[model samples]
Target: MKKLLCIVLCLALASSLLFACASPAATETTDAAATEATASEAAATEEPAATADEPVTITILRPGDEEKVKSFLEPAVQQFEAENPNITVEIMYESWAGWIQTYPTYFEADTQPDVIFWWDNKLYDSSAHDHLVNLSNYLSEDFFSQIPQGIWDLVDTGDMDGVYYVPNSVDTFVMYYNKDVFTAAGLDPNTPPTTWDELLTDVQTIYDVTGTPGIGIPAITGSEVLEEFVGLFLNQATDASVLDSSSMPLFNTADGLSALTMVQNLSKYAQTSPTEYGRGELRALLRDGQVGIIFDGPWAVPTFKAAYGDDLDNSPIGIATVPLAANGKKIDWAGTNGWIATRESTAAASAKLIEFLMSPEILLSHHIIYGSAPLYASEFDNAAFQYDYWKVFYDEAQNYKLYGMIGRNSATPAAYYTALEEVWQQLVLGQISAEDAQAAAAAAAEGVTARNN
Candidate 1:
């Protein structure tokens, strides 16, 4: 009996050991299955990354000389593509003249490039405002903070609530003169005009002595050239903007009359058929020594450099701050152009590309190649910006009371050109008095308020 009881005890101990070991194996198998199921569910829900089979192609426009633009842009595009294998970027090159004429048509067709190098003041001029993406939606606060607050304020026209443009070029006007012309006029080449009276005297002296046109006046209608040319003097005389924020004429005062009168006086010595020239033509005239003086932006630097070589300040081309008006504060007209993304579908990719372009190295390179003043404070240290002529521009940008274009903040940004084009042409042609021009400008402003507001 004792032997049989011992045998039963042994059998029970063996069964207990087997059940403990089997229980652990079953628990581990169940846990493994649960983990696999969870991973599979997560894979089903998560968004997929872009792949070779599903590539995204985006187009961006770089408006300039085709060969010059392609020289820098093509390599940059290749680098961007290599970094982002799934994205293919196409660059559309258009000359400045051609782009200006065709940009409106681009919006009409809904076939605008995904991203465009755009004019800041003209943001709301056409259907472009509707198509532009509010970059604030996609870019982070850190990204927006990269630019100065002043620049942000300048670009924020209050047309809409969000940022629509990323300014890459913040340009102000400067007086460009030909030293050869000045020397021939019996004037010191280094002593350019500093006041409206002095400018008038210099113009008369140059024309009298050298027989060259004292200046090239860009009075071409249907373009912003005439508007900018007159507006700069208006800014100098009034020390204020020509149009109020509401697009009302602010230049109908006595000071405004004087400014227009000065413009008319200066027109007498300008190249014949002043209406035939635009800013670009004026630059060419300056280059060829046909005109003694003209107001232009830093964009003329590269061309002048090519014509005059590396030392532009010492070359025949001379740059100075825009001449001031009597009793006028140091003021000048400023404008900006930047990148704008138009397509909502390509916003992400466009933003990525913009961020890449705005990187310090790339942006500096762009400023150098495009002959723009350094947009960032950090860029001032670059060797490319170290030229003497750049200081005049940089000073104007930093120290001057800069006003933007007329109607820049209004719904009808192009009102300045539309309303004043004919009268301005008449004023420049000496067919109308300055008082008449002022009255016509005021009426045009009124028309803009009525039509747009």
Candidate 2:
């Protein structure tokens, strides 16, 4: 009986030990499952897709008709949005009218633009001098390399002989002529006039046959229309950098006088007085075949296409280089507008956009659509663009010079150009000779220097 009781006790102890071990193992699995469930829930809830509830707006300022801009630019913006889901671009159209008034006020205030298109010369230099952001760090080296050479040079302030802005396009004069107008008038459409004398002769021939002036120039009130036309003449005769490098007025020279006189003497054959050739009127005249030739930018190409097509339905138009001087020299004035951040506001995001905009693909698009010369060698896609017009500009871009107030100081240039504007108007109107105009310009420039220094 004692041996039997001892055996039962020993069996019970072994069973008890086995049960304890199983209990611990079961609890561990439950804990692991609970922890894994919590982790899975967290992983599922971590990232949320973007919703319309959040939208960011960035602004850009550019030129040309708002309607025209929207038709072309909206698509490009949409393309950008596909890649940058977080960003939205809002475009604002700026005009030459009261531009100075509008731009400075917006820039100086705390509410600033994320990016904008700006004239890189005197305007940018002034912005830089005021301690606005410098975009040098943000713009990439590849982007810098993509800019056409002359276009990039225009943005350099020549302060430290360094660049402050990133140029995007080359804006300059090009010739627009009515194909139907010339054809109907028995003029050869195959040849475009290259020299000043030939241009006048063609106009004379057109008028003799059609009773309409062959060429039109705006001698009237606007600064841009008058100044650029005059600049072309100055450029053809001599180096335009004389004024910029020397900071002196050279308008009295034979070159300047000849440039001014070329248009002044053309008054008899012009369709309208200088003041009469405002943009609105010019567009109408060019389309109607009342005026045969005018100097314009790439911006006009699409407009001509829409209105005229390849036929004279609206009177077909053709593009050519701006007419050269009587000396047979071509001097086309080009303006390169670029993106600039004030020194204080230069940011990484801004540079990233600049980098994107400066890519070869973007530049090629810019060239084909905007008529800017290609900045990259690969962008030539010569087969696609299929126009010799690009070469005319590409060749000229290498030699052309940019003008404007671009020094360490902006106030002097602002004031000086304002004064020179008056002198320019007087010269264009034939109220003063080149000599007198130069003296007035000199006096005004000297006054600004003296006061500022």
Candidate 3:
């Protein structure tokens, strides 16, 4: 009986040991399963990190000749795409005239391009002004530092708090002369006019000697060219803006009267039917040697180059700074065009593309292709800018108090131009005295101010 009881005890002890060992193995397996399940659940709930190769697409447009813009932009777009891989860029081409008419519609529909080539003076008056993403938030200080402070001030309308435009093109006016016309007039080609009196004398001499209009005045009745042409004289005479920041008529002052009188005196030698011609017509006349002088911007370079080739700066064309007023302040009428990113969703990529476009190498090429004055100080060193013609433009950009369009901040920015055109035409045609013209212009400006401000 004792041997049987001992055997039972031994069996119970073995069973207990087996049970303890099996329990531990089962717990270990359960723990391993729980860890695996927890990891799977975690992966299911959490998102994977985004890779650099994520797809994105953005569209861009510049209002200009489609062929010319595409010629330079298509290759740049290809390079940009290759470098980015994840981003696709599409260029929406529109002509200047057509875009001017259609842009308001695009802005109203929220269908404007992701990135746009825009006018600085007109931005405050456009629908896109409110839609533009503040570029200051995306562009770095280093990028802003590359441009001059004067340029930034030129584009500021005082209507906005942040930088919305990235000015790539800065343009100022200079007087372009035909050397042949100067020689025919018995005036030295190398010695162009230096003052308002000299300019008038030279125009008269050229008209008397050559029997051709000495200067082409672009006073097309509904166009802005006349306003710009007269505004330069006003800026030079008054040493002030044509319209104050409040869009009031600054051109109705005594200095403004003197400027108008100067324009009237000079008009004696200008082309017949001045109201029929625009700046483009005048430039064409200058290029053909039919007009002795025209005040134009750097955009005239390419046209003259195509016509004259290597002799552009030599015997045929003579470029000089716009003649000084009696006050001798070096002031000029200037304008700017730049890039603006409109869509908030694509602002990041749009800024990236703008940065790429504004890079020194790319910007230089753009300036060359667009025939614009160099915006960067570093660009002056480029071989393309080494010419004497470019030097005149560069110096003017450096020295002048560059003023923008009149009524730039007005609700109807074109009103200033329209208001002055008829009265200016009358002044040039001798239908009204300069004093009367001044009053008419003032009344028109007051009407615009009342309606717009």
Candidate 4:
């Protein structure tokens, strides 16, 4: 009986060992199956495409003014960044000294900024049309619904068939007079010049009475200087197409001579060696109260206000619509400074950045701080825009069919503007006759047209 019991115990021990080994294999198989199923479920579920840890960087080019950026642009960018934590904005501020030459180079190279601050009239035709993306197809309908029709109409001009640029602000050259200078000259500062004759006579009066230069004209070799002529005269002329259908000079006519003569007459009372000053330097002369009148854009309001403090609206300075044309007309050049993007850029990200910049809240804030006229019609009702000077600008923007140096619905060769500036410098310096300047400009334009063809 004892032997039988031992055999049974040994058999039970063997069975227990076998059960233990089999249990481990079964458990391992079940665990492996559960892990695989869990991983497959996770793979099928929708997850956030991007996380805060992995962010995209969007680069942009903007002319830098630290104070101005701090006052407005920087804050707007901060707001954008806060809203879009997954995206970053890298801003590079190129100086005007080399910007004109360097800006075009950016597109030629493989590394270009995702977005660029382009002058709607200046670079829109040349840089934007060729290199940038046509945004009309990508922009949402709600975006178009927010902007004014007239503002959008200006974008689709000449060979630019689609909306390739978005204008942040609209501006025109207006007459900013130093009221103190006017008062010192015993002239009524309240009554700004209405006619070209009045403008010249007032300038001469300021010179004769104040012993300071009556006006400071930007006569340098640039499109800004040419726009002075176009703003002051060409818009008033009967047919102001500076470039005809074929991009040839059309300004050498009788109206052209007359415009040159008007500028030449005013030059006599202008700061000596006016060509020595660029627009910003010339504006500085006005800011220091050395010049009585300055033909500048609304973009300069911040500087003017910064210089004169509380007296910006009266006593020291006043803003007026640009002097009227000889035929009792009021027309001038205007620009909608644009935010343009490149075709090679990450379109989704770049478009979002543009939409952020042009958003009504940010744009209106910029206008309020920088004094640029807003493109959005909703901005017209802001309390900040109720000032008389702003009213003058708004009236001109609404009434006059303003164009940039390269007229509305038209484009000009870069050489044409270059020639106009050279001719204007000579004309202002007493080195060339109005007729001669006109002739030289037309001839240079003809050469440019031929070369382009």
TM-score of each: 0.80, 0.71, 0.85, 0.77
lDDT of 3 at 101: 91
The positional error of residue 376 in candidate 1, measured at the CA in angstroms, is: 2.6
lDDT tens digits, residue span 1-453, model 1: 999999999999999999999998999999999999999999989655333335789899989889878876888888889988878899998998999778889998988898888887777776677898877767767778887666676675565878788988789999999999999889999889998999999999999998999988988868887888899988888877787767788889999999999999999999999888888888889999999999989877877888888788678999999988898578888888889998776777787788778777778888888888887778878877777888888788877878776666665677667778877889999999999999988897788788876
- Please report, as a residue range, the 10-residue window in candidate 2 with the lowest summed lDDT: 403-412
List the lowest-lDDT window of 10 residues for candidate 4. Answer: 405-414
Off by over 4 Å in 3: 1-55
Q: After superposition, how far is residue 197 of candidate 3 from its true place, in Å?
A: 1.6
Candidate 3 local distance difference test against the native: 0.85
Predicted candidate 3: what Cα RMSD to the true structure?
A: 10.7
Q: Over the stretch 396-453, how does candidate 3's per-residue lDDT look in tens digits?
A: 7766888887766765787778877888889988899999999998888888889774
Model 1: which ten-residue window has the lowest total lDDT? 46-55
The predictions' CA RMSDs to the true structure, in order, are 10.8, 14.5, 10.7, 12.9
lDDT of 2 by residue, 358-420 (tens): 667665666666545555566657553445555555566665554433232444455554555
**What lDDT does each candidate get?**
0.84, 0.62, 0.85, 0.73
Candidate 4 per-residue lDDT, tens place, 1-453, comes to: 999999999999999999998998999999999999998898778432333345778787766565665666567778888988878888776655566677657766746687877776654345445677777766788987777565665454566577778877768778888887898999998898988889999999999998989988887665456445543576576446566656677677787778878877888899998778877887788777799998878877777767765336664778888887677766776767778877543556677778888888888887886678756667767776655667677777767766565533333445666766777788888899878877887897777777766
**Ten contiguous residues with the weakest lDDT in model 3:** 46-55
Clashing pairs in 3: none
Clashing pairs in 4: none
